[model samples]
Target: MTQHDTDHALKTGGEQGYLRIATEEAFATREQIDVYLRMVRDGTADRGMTSLWGFYAQSPSERAMQIIERLLDLGERRIADMDATGIDKAILALTSPGVQPFSDTHEAQRIARSANDLLAERCAAHPDRFIGMTAVAPQDPQWSAEEIRRGAHDLGFKGVQINSHTQGRYLDEPFFDPIFRALSDTGQPLYIHPGTPPDAMIGPLLDAGLDGAIYGFGVETGMHLLRLITIGIFDRYPDLQIMVGHMGEALPYWLYRLDYMHQAGIRSARYERMKPLKKTIADYFRSNVLVTCSGMAWEPAIRFAQQVMGEDRVMYAMDYPYQYEAHEVRALDAMELTPEVKRQFFQTNAERWFKL
Candidate 1:
């Protein structure tokens, strides 16, 4: 079927009887973009940030330009795009490398608060079509904790989005306990979105032109999640809910190996930090973590993730603007899933996880 016809069919509640609630949609405020541009100009940006945002800032390519334009729009244009792509509603968040790149704690906190306020405003303006996720500066854990509460209590945001690794520091560190405590206390899921690798890890990836979305994002984000698991983040914050996009950043496929290798490392006492956990690597995934098939519409991969992670733990995400392709929506709609399962994949799971 044609793209327009497919969209129309979905909108009209066609054979695909499910609402598409895209959970990982992204938007960026103009102020954030301006800060990114200034960082690029001043040569003070993180290497990965420079590689990703700098390219988009300067590159005149149609894809880069289109993404930039779409990222800046949170109004009718964004809603129209969603309608045209068969998405019923979107859980919106700040684009990656958000506020996490700023070394100045106050500056980062200010910008993050501004971004959260803008997102809350956009969501309120389009309550039926948009849902807001809190963005906070992890540079100051206490401030981040307070922002999380403010976003949940005052702004009505449903969850928190942290771009992976703040200034080379991962959430696995004890310093981030306040943020985790807040998330658990507030019952808001924490979506760990991908950012470009830090300086320590971006050199090789950038040299190979894979420092952005293609390879580095998954590597960095997957490592972040694994670090949380191995370091027993979930044991400390048992009530915390963590969401990872791109089919759990390919972590599901490596579950067996991860579990085995992790056990081996602990048995050998090869690393002082590798301690025993109450559960296995995969157990944490099944329990505390949720996965989204954002930018990953392939049938086999999605099905494999569902099979391994449990059907209820997997949900749909368009990865909007970055991997925006209406055909992907059509493809997901065509997956060979039973009616109930399809509904869970495209709609109910998101509603449940994000508390929509």
Candidate 2:
């Protein structure tokens, strides 16, 4: 179907007493893509990067080309796609594995700054329609912290986007405390977007052709978030808010098991890193984290997430360009949420969390 036909079929949230604010939309700059291409060519990229960006960079298929094109455009095309899908505003971030693949800290920092600048320009051009999140290279914690302050104070970005892990190093480690401090100090929520698993964990998933968004992304990112919780990140930075897409990366469904096993591990002292936390795993989720239904439009999952995560902590996202299915928007619009809850899901919650 044509874009116009899709737009016509989907009743916008405005017509249903809410505005659809898609919080996990992604965009990219050509410079960033060029760097990715170079990394793939030079054989310096990690296995996950090779599997994900290498495919995109080398694929001759029309769908791959189209996704690359869409990722590069933050102007008329992206806005039109949002309009066609009944999205009133999009909270934009650099696509996954952003600058995280660069081992050269200076190079990573430079590209991250440039990407944030370009994002700021795009958002400024259409402030009412676009909100930007800061993309930082966590390869250099101090540099990333500096960039976060600049993005929030100078560029006006709402939050910070860290694509799961940086150089196979999760943010729960002590080396990343600077970035967390910056985020807490700036009151910018951390949006942990998904990336393919690192080499240590990707071999089996890659062997099965399940290394990208199909499954590996969630498993890798969910473990990343859990690492933070178990290490008492929220207890250290009590005001640091976080967001994870794809229905909390399946975290909600496993909350009970997570709590039980986490406590068991702590009691046994099976691992040196595992320590008693200030709160249960589920409590941290309820108090510190928010979940968006990006690429997860199923009503049962959405309702279950809301029931578990609290209605206020659940929001809407389209996972644009990557999973741009107009029918997903239609499905969300057709959900049986009350007017107040629908407004919270589609609009106000994002507004409150991101300060958008």
Candidate 3:
């Protein structure tokens, strides 16, 4: 691997007898909260988005505001959480719906750059405990491409974190190729984190209290990944590596059905034709995607992900603040994986994927 801008090598923990590097950890900037608050105050915020943001919002509830304050912290408190969780290092990204919701392209670009600069400063302040990911607004693909280069090449961020969609714009659209090319040039992975679904698509699910992470998040994120695969994204940028949390966002369980359905639809001559991919959905996963055990601590999910995506593609994460620290770490320990497998899941795979 090439030399990374952060001092990742110097970051290690001897206390646990094994180094634990967690990815998929999230944080938000005060500026980010301010933007959302303004949207809410002006009655311009998406109602569904407002409901989802309440989970990590800094207003409306004093307790929720405390959590938001914690999310804004990247200093001693965060490090203490890591220590308690048995994690030595964490890869940090701006929280979901980052700048992706902004309708103004210039405003989105400004927020993306500012969030990245703040995250970079924090990582530089405590390189041993944190690694940063670039936040880009896919609303302006060309400008976002430039920010990706600026963040990864100059600011020491390891990769880019894209909230699943921009407003309703998913990454599979042809307009996002510039962003993909920029990421491809860096040889850095794109972390496809979840956001609330588009307004038109959120019907009924929200009424059932199945929005946010209960189900909507997985549905939206998983479909976004499938769109990337079936829409010839991997064919265009074959070297690109995509990362997703929540144990592949429930994709591993449906791989055979997805591949089979795609083939059946093509053979029936009933579906509209688009660009053809060089490989199947399952093949792209094997060659171009990685999954992390973030937020979900179920052994069956982890084992099933390993069975389908291979142990090498799996990594460990706590999801921080949202998921309990000690419980997840204890679950990882109790999985009884071989020492070598444990090392790959805990540290080495992350090091390899992020070029740390």
Q: What is the per-residue lDDT of model 3 for residues 141-259, given as tens digits with 9 covering 90 to 100? A: 89889989998889998999999978888888888989999999988899999988888788777888887888999999999999888888888888899999999999988999988
Off by over 4 Å in 2: 1-8, 11-13
- Whole-model lDDT per candidate: 0.90, 0.90, 0.83
What range of 10 consecutive residues in model 1 has the weakest lDDT sum? Answer: 5-14
Superposed model 1: Cα runs more than 4 Å off: 1-15
Relative to the true structure, candidate 3 reaches a TM of 0.93
Q: Higher TM-score: candidate 2 or 3?
A: 2
Candidate 1's residue-wise lDDT over 123-187, tens digit each?
88989899999999998999999999999999999999999999899999999999999998899
RMSD of each: 1.9, 2.6, 5.8
TM-scores across all candidates? 0.96, 0.96, 0.93
- Candidate 3's C-alpha runs over 4 A off are 1-17, 58-63, 273-275
Per-residue lDDT of 162 in model 2: 95
